[model samples]
Target: MKCEYDKDTESLKIELSEEIDMSTCKTLRNIMDGYIIKYSPKECVLDLEKVNFMDSSGLGLIMGRYNLIKMMNSKMTILNPGDYIKKILGMTELAKDVKII
Candidate 1:
Protein backbone atom coordinates (compact mmCIF):
# COMPACT_ATOMS: atom_id res chain seq x y z
CA MET A 1 0.00 0.00 0.00
CA LYS A 2 1.14 3.57 -0.80
CA CYS A 3 0.01 6.62 1.17
CA GLU A 4 0.37 10.32 0.49
CA TYR A 5 -0.59 13.31 2.56
CA ASP A 6 -1.64 16.65 1.13
CA LYS A 7 -0.96 19.26 3.74
CA ASP A 8 -2.72 21.95 1.78
CA THR A 9 -6.20 20.36 1.89
CA GLU A 10 -5.48 18.62 5.15
CA SER A 11 -6.39 15.49 3.20
CA LEU A 12 -4.59 12.25 3.77
CA LYS A 13 -5.06 10.31 0.55
CA ILE A 14 -4.06 6.68 0.86
CA GLU A 15 -3.61 4.78 -2.37
CA LEU A 16 -4.06 1.17 -1.41
CA SER A 17 -2.67 -0.93 -4.24
CA GLU A 18 -2.96 -4.39 -2.76
CA GLU A 19 -4.75 -6.43 -0.15
CA ILE A 20 -5.17 -4.71 3.16
CA ASP A 21 -4.19 -7.65 5.29
CA MET A 22 -2.70 -7.96 8.76
CA SER A 23 0.86 -7.21 7.79
CA THR A 24 0.11 -4.13 5.75
CA CYS A 25 -2.39 -2.87 8.31
CA LYS A 26 0.34 -1.95 10.75
CA THR A 27 2.26 0.05 8.21
CA LEU A 28 -0.86 1.75 7.03
CA ARG A 29 -1.93 2.70 10.50
CA ASN A 30 1.43 4.15 11.32
CA ILE A 31 1.65 6.17 8.14
CA MET A 32 -1.90 7.44 8.48
CA ASP A 33 -1.39 8.47 12.07
CA GLY A 34 1.71 10.37 11.14
CA TYR A 35 -0.04 12.30 8.41
CA ILE A 36 -3.13 12.96 10.48
CA ILE A 37 -1.06 14.46 13.24
CA LYS A 38 1.34 16.31 11.00
CA TYR A 39 -1.23 17.90 8.74
CA SER A 40 -4.13 17.93 11.16
CA PRO A 41 -6.33 18.22 8.11
CA LYS A 42 -9.99 19.05 8.37
CA GLU A 43 -10.67 16.16 6.02
CA CYS A 44 -9.24 12.83 4.91
CA VAL A 45 -9.66 10.93 1.68
CA LEU A 46 -8.94 7.24 1.27
CA ASP A 47 -8.39 6.37 -2.34
CA LEU A 48 -9.36 2.74 -2.72
CA GLU A 49 -9.63 2.71 -6.45
CA LYS A 50 -6.46 0.67 -6.75
CA VAL A 51 -7.21 -1.74 -3.96
CA ASN A 52 -7.98 -5.27 -5.05
CA PHE A 53 -8.94 -6.78 -1.71
CA MET A 54 -9.47 -5.81 1.88
CA ASP A 55 -10.45 -7.56 5.09
CA SER A 56 -11.84 -6.56 8.46
CA SER A 57 -8.54 -4.99 9.32
CA GLY A 58 -9.09 -2.50 6.56
CA LEU A 59 -12.51 -1.74 7.91
CA GLY A 60 -11.02 -1.14 11.31
CA LEU A 61 -8.58 1.35 9.83
CA ILE A 62 -11.37 3.29 8.22
CA MET A 63 -13.42 3.29 11.39
CA GLY A 64 -10.50 4.39 13.49
CA ARG A 65 -9.72 7.29 11.20
CA TYR A 66 -13.33 8.29 11.10
CA ASN A 67 -13.43 8.50 14.85
CA LEU A 68 -10.24 10.49 14.98
CA ILE A 69 -11.33 12.96 12.34
CA LYS A 70 -14.72 13.32 13.99
CA MET A 71 -13.12 14.35 17.24
CA MET A 72 -11.27 17.08 15.38
CA ASN A 73 -14.48 18.32 13.82
CA SER A 74 -13.24 17.10 10.46
CA LYS A 75 -14.52 14.63 7.89
CA MET A 76 -13.39 11.45 6.17
CA THR A 77 -14.15 10.39 2.65
CA ILE A 78 -13.53 7.26 0.61
CA LEU A 79 -13.01 7.87 -3.04
CA ASN A 80 -13.38 5.62 -6.12
CA PRO A 81 -13.46 2.28 -4.38
CA GLY A 82 -13.60 -0.82 -6.50
CA ASP A 83 -16.56 -3.18 -6.46
CA TYR A 84 -15.13 -5.55 -3.87
CA ILE A 85 -14.19 -2.75 -1.53
CA LYS A 86 -17.54 -1.14 -2.07
CA LYS A 87 -19.31 -4.30 -0.96
CA ILE A 88 -17.24 -4.47 2.17
CA LEU A 89 -17.91 -0.84 2.94
CA GLY A 90 -21.62 -1.34 2.41
CA MET A 91 -21.67 -4.47 4.55
CA THR A 92 -19.86 -2.58 7.25
CA GLU A 93 -22.43 0.18 6.90
CA LEU A 94 -19.84 2.83 6.25
CA ALA A 95 -21.19 4.14 2.99
CA LYS A 96 -22.66 7.11 4.77
CA ASP A 97 -19.62 7.66 6.87
CA VAL A 98 -17.49 8.56 3.87
CA LYS A 99 -18.22 10.07 0.53
CA ILE A 100 -17.76 7.79 -2.50
CA ILE A 101 -17.12 10.37 -5.12
Candidate 2:
Protein backbone atom coordinates (compact mmCIF):
# COMPACT_ATOMS: atom_id res chain seq x y z
CA MET A 1 0.00 0.00 0.00
CA LYS A 2 1.08 3.56 -0.72
CA CYS A 3 -0.26 6.65 0.95
CA GLU A 4 -0.21 10.23 -0.25
CA TYR A 5 -1.27 13.32 1.57
CA ASP A 6 -2.33 16.58 -0.06
CA LYS A 7 -2.02 19.44 2.29
CA ASP A 8 -3.80 21.90 0.05
CA THR A 9 -6.83 19.67 -0.29
CA GLU A 10 -6.43 18.23 3.19
CA SER A 11 -6.81 14.79 1.67
CA LEU A 12 -5.03 11.53 2.38
CA LYS A 13 -5.26 8.93 -0.34
CA ILE A 14 -4.25 5.30 0.23
CA GLU A 15 -3.41 3.17 -2.78
CA LEU A 16 -3.97 -0.51 -2.09
CA SER A 17 -2.51 -3.26 -4.21
CA GLU A 18 -2.79 -7.00 -4.84
CA GLU A 19 -4.24 -8.53 -1.69
CA ILE A 20 -5.27 -7.33 1.74
CA ASP A 21 -5.05 -10.41 3.86
CA MET A 22 -3.16 -11.72 6.88
CA SER A 23 0.13 -11.26 5.09
CA THR A 24 -0.34 -7.59 4.34
CA CYS A 25 -3.12 -6.21 6.50
CA LYS A 26 -0.88 -5.38 9.44
CA THR A 27 1.51 -3.30 7.39
CA LEU A 28 -1.37 -1.70 5.55
CA ARG A 29 -3.08 -0.83 8.81
CA ASN A 30 0.08 0.66 10.27
CA ILE A 31 0.72 2.77 7.22
CA MET A 32 -2.84 4.05 7.10
CA ASP A 33 -3.19 4.64 10.81
CA GLY A 34 0.09 6.49 11.04
CA TYR A 35 -0.82 8.75 8.14
CA ILE A 36 -4.23 9.55 9.60
CA ILE A 37 -2.84 10.36 13.01
CA LYS A 38 -0.15 12.58 11.57
CA TYR A 39 -2.02 14.51 8.94
CA SER A 40 -5.59 14.33 10.17
CA PRO A 41 -6.81 15.07 6.69
CA LYS A 42 -10.28 16.35 6.01
CA GLU A 43 -10.75 13.61 3.43
CA CYS A 44 -9.36 10.08 3.51
CA VAL A 45 -9.68 7.88 0.44
CA LEU A 46 -8.92 4.21 -0.01
CA ASP A 47 -8.09 3.43 -3.63
CA LEU A 48 -8.72 -0.21 -4.31
CA GLU A 49 -8.26 -0.24 -8.05
CA LYS A 50 -5.31 -2.61 -7.93
CA VAL A 51 -6.54 -4.91 -5.21
CA ASN A 52 -7.72 -8.28 -6.49
CA PHE A 53 -8.39 -9.94 -3.16
CA MET A 54 -9.27 -9.05 0.39
CA ASP A 55 -10.35 -11.03 3.41
CA SER A 56 -12.25 -10.24 6.59
CA SER A 57 -9.17 -8.63 8.04
CA GLY A 58 -9.40 -6.12 5.24
CA LEU A 59 -12.92 -5.33 6.38
CA GLY A 60 -11.62 -4.69 9.85
CA LEU A 61 -9.04 -2.29 8.49
CA ILE A 62 -11.68 -0.46 6.52
CA MET A 63 -14.06 -0.21 9.43
CA GLY A 64 -11.36 0.90 11.84
CA ARG A 65 -10.24 3.70 9.58
CA TYR A 66 -13.83 4.73 8.92
CA ASN A 67 -14.47 5.04 12.61
CA LEU A 68 -11.23 6.85 13.27
CA ILE A 69 -11.86 9.48 10.64
CA LYS A 70 -15.51 9.81 11.56
CA MET A 71 -14.58 10.52 15.16
CA MET A 72 -12.37 13.29 13.85
CA ASN A 73 -15.35 14.65 11.88
CA SER A 74 -13.69 13.76 8.60
CA LYS A 75 -14.86 11.95 5.48
CA MET A 76 -13.65 8.57 4.26
CA THR A 77 -14.16 7.27 0.72
CA ILE A 78 -13.33 4.10 -1.14
CA LEU A 79 -12.52 4.44 -4.79
CA ASN A 80 -12.22 2.16 -7.80
CA PRO A 81 -12.96 -1.16 -6.12
CA GLY A 82 -13.82 -3.88 -8.61
CA ASP A 83 -17.10 -5.80 -8.59
CA TYR A 84 -15.78 -8.44 -6.22
CA ILE A 85 -14.63 -5.92 -3.71
CA LYS A 86 -17.90 -4.05 -4.05
CA LYS A 87 -19.87 -7.19 -3.25
CA ILE A 88 -17.72 -7.85 -0.22
CA LEU A 89 -18.18 -4.28 0.94
CA GLY A 90 -21.90 -4.34 0.27
CA MET A 91 -22.29 -7.28 2.59
CA THR A 92 -20.71 -5.43 5.47
CA GLU A 93 -21.91 -2.72 7.83
CA LEU A 94 -18.76 -0.81 6.93
CA ALA A 95 -20.57 0.33 3.81
CA LYS A 96 -22.82 2.44 5.97
CA ASP A 97 -19.85 4.36 7.27
CA VAL A 98 -17.75 4.54 4.11
CA LYS A 99 -18.56 6.14 0.79
CA ILE A 100 -17.51 4.12 -2.23
CA ILE A 101 -17.20 5.71 -5.62
Candidate 3:
Protein backbone atom coordinates (compact mmCIF):
# COMPACT_ATOMS: atom_id res chain seq x y z
CA MET A 1 0.00 0.00 0.00
CA LYS A 2 1.12 3.60 -0.73
CA CYS A 3 -0.25 7.00 0.20
CA GLU A 4 0.42 10.47 -1.10
CA TYR A 5 -0.85 13.51 0.68
CA ASP A 6 -1.40 16.71 -1.27
CA LYS A 7 -0.93 19.35 1.38
CA ASP A 8 -1.92 22.21 -0.86
CA THR A 9 -5.51 21.08 -1.35
CA GLU A 10 -5.68 19.17 1.94
CA SER A 11 -6.42 16.15 -0.12
CA LEU A 12 -5.17 12.63 0.54
CA LYS A 13 -5.08 10.19 -2.32
CA ILE A 14 -4.17 6.63 -1.43
CA GLU A 15 -2.98 4.27 -4.09
CA LEU A 16 -3.63 0.77 -2.89
CA SER A 17 -1.82 -2.13 -4.52
CA GLU A 18 -2.31 -5.85 -4.69
CA GLU A 19 -4.60 -6.97 -1.90
CA ILE A 20 -5.99 -5.10 1.06
CA ASP A 21 -6.32 -8.01 3.40
CA MET A 22 -5.47 -8.69 7.05
CA SER A 23 -1.79 -8.66 6.21
CA THR A 24 -1.64 -5.00 5.20
CA CYS A 25 -4.68 -3.43 6.77
CA LYS A 26 -2.87 -2.27 9.87
CA THR A 27 -0.14 -0.52 7.99
CA LEU A 28 -2.64 0.97 5.61
CA ARG A 29 -4.77 2.18 8.48
CA ASN A 30 -1.86 3.67 10.35
CA ILE A 31 -0.46 5.50 7.37
CA MET A 32 -3.79 6.89 6.31
CA ASP A 33 -4.85 7.81 9.82
CA GLY A 34 -1.63 9.69 10.44
CA TYR A 35 -1.91 11.63 7.21
CA ILE A 36 -5.55 12.35 7.78
CA ILE A 37 -4.92 13.71 11.24
CA LYS A 38 -1.78 15.56 10.26
CA TYR A 39 -3.27 17.20 7.21
CA SER A 40 -6.88 17.44 8.38
CA PRO A 41 -7.90 17.29 4.78
CA LYS A 42 -11.21 18.74 3.76
CA GLU A 43 -11.55 15.80 1.42
CA CYS A 44 -9.99 12.40 0.95
CA VAL A 45 -9.80 10.36 -2.22
CA LEU A 46 -8.78 6.72 -2.02
CA ASP A 47 -7.67 5.48 -5.40
CA LEU A 48 -8.21 1.76 -5.52
CA GLU A 49 -7.72 1.35 -9.22
CA LYS A 50 -4.62 -0.72 -8.64
CA VAL A 51 -6.01 -2.95 -5.94
CA ASN A 52 -6.97 -6.45 -7.02
CA PHE A 53 -8.35 -7.75 -3.73
CA MET A 54 -9.90 -6.59 -0.49
CA ASP A 55 -11.45 -8.14 2.59
CA SER A 56 -13.68 -7.06 5.44
CA SER A 57 -10.85 -5.20 7.11
CA GLY A 58 -10.48 -3.12 4.01
CA LEU A 59 -14.11 -2.21 4.17
CA GLY A 60 -13.69 -1.27 7.82
CA LEU A 61 -10.94 1.13 6.96
CA ILE A 62 -13.10 2.89 4.43
CA MET A 63 -15.97 3.14 6.85
CA GLY A 64 -13.74 4.37 9.64
CA ARG A 65 -12.40 7.15 7.49
CA TYR A 66 -15.85 8.09 6.35
CA ASN A 67 -17.09 8.40 9.91
CA LEU A 68 -14.06 10.36 10.94
CA ILE A 69 -14.30 12.79 8.06
CA LYS A 70 -18.03 13.12 8.34
CA MET A 71 -17.73 14.17 11.96
CA MET A 72 -15.55 17.04 10.79
CA ASN A 73 -17.89 17.85 7.95
CA SER A 74 -15.35 16.76 5.37
CA LYS A 75 -15.90 14.61 2.33
CA MET A 76 -14.44 11.24 1.37
CA THR A 77 -14.43 9.50 -1.99
CA ILE A 78 -13.26 6.17 -3.34
CA LEU A 79 -12.15 6.25 -6.94
CA ASN A 80 -11.70 3.70 -9.66
CA PRO A 81 -12.07 0.46 -7.77
CA GLY A 82 -12.20 -2.61 -9.92
CA ASP A 83 -15.26 -4.80 -10.25
CA TYR A 84 -14.29 -7.10 -7.43
CA ILE A 85 -13.75 -4.34 -4.93
CA LYS A 86 -16.87 -2.57 -6.09
CA LYS A 87 -18.91 -5.68 -5.48
CA ILE A 88 -17.64 -5.95 -1.94
CA LEU A 89 -18.49 -2.37 -1.17
CA GLY A 90 -21.86 -2.77 -2.79
CA MET A 91 -22.58 -5.89 -0.78
CA THR A 92 -21.63 -4.15 2.41
CA GLU A 93 -23.75 -1.15 1.46
CA LEU A 94 -20.77 1.15 1.78
CA ALA A 95 -20.91 2.14 -1.86
CA LYS A 96 -23.69 4.48 -0.89
CA ASP A 97 -21.49 5.97 1.77
CA VAL A 98 -18.88 7.22 -0.67
CA LYS A 99 -18.62 8.67 -4.11
CA ILE A 100 -17.28 5.88 -6.29
CA ILE A 101 -16.33 7.05 -9.73
* Candidate with maximal lDDT: 2
Can you write out model 1's per-residue Cα lDDT over 1-101, one digit (the tens) per residue? 56677767767776767688887888888878777777778888888888777898988988887888888888888888778778888886677767877
- Locate the minimum summed-lDDT window of 10 residues in model 2: 18-27
Q: TM-score ranking from best to worst?
A: 2, 3, 1
The candidate scoring highest on TM-score is 2
What are the candidates' C-alpha RMSDs? 1.8, 1.1, 1.6
> What lDDT does each candidate get?
0.79, 0.89, 0.82
Ranking by lDDT: 2, 3, 1
Kindly give the number of clashing pairs for every candidate. 0, 0, 0
Clashes of 1: 0
lDDT of 2 by residue, 1-101 (tens): 78899989999998998588888888888888999999999999999999888978888889888989999999999999888888889998888878899
Query: Candidate 1, overall lDDT?
Result: 0.79
> lDDT score of model 3?
0.82
How many residue pairs clash in model 2?
0
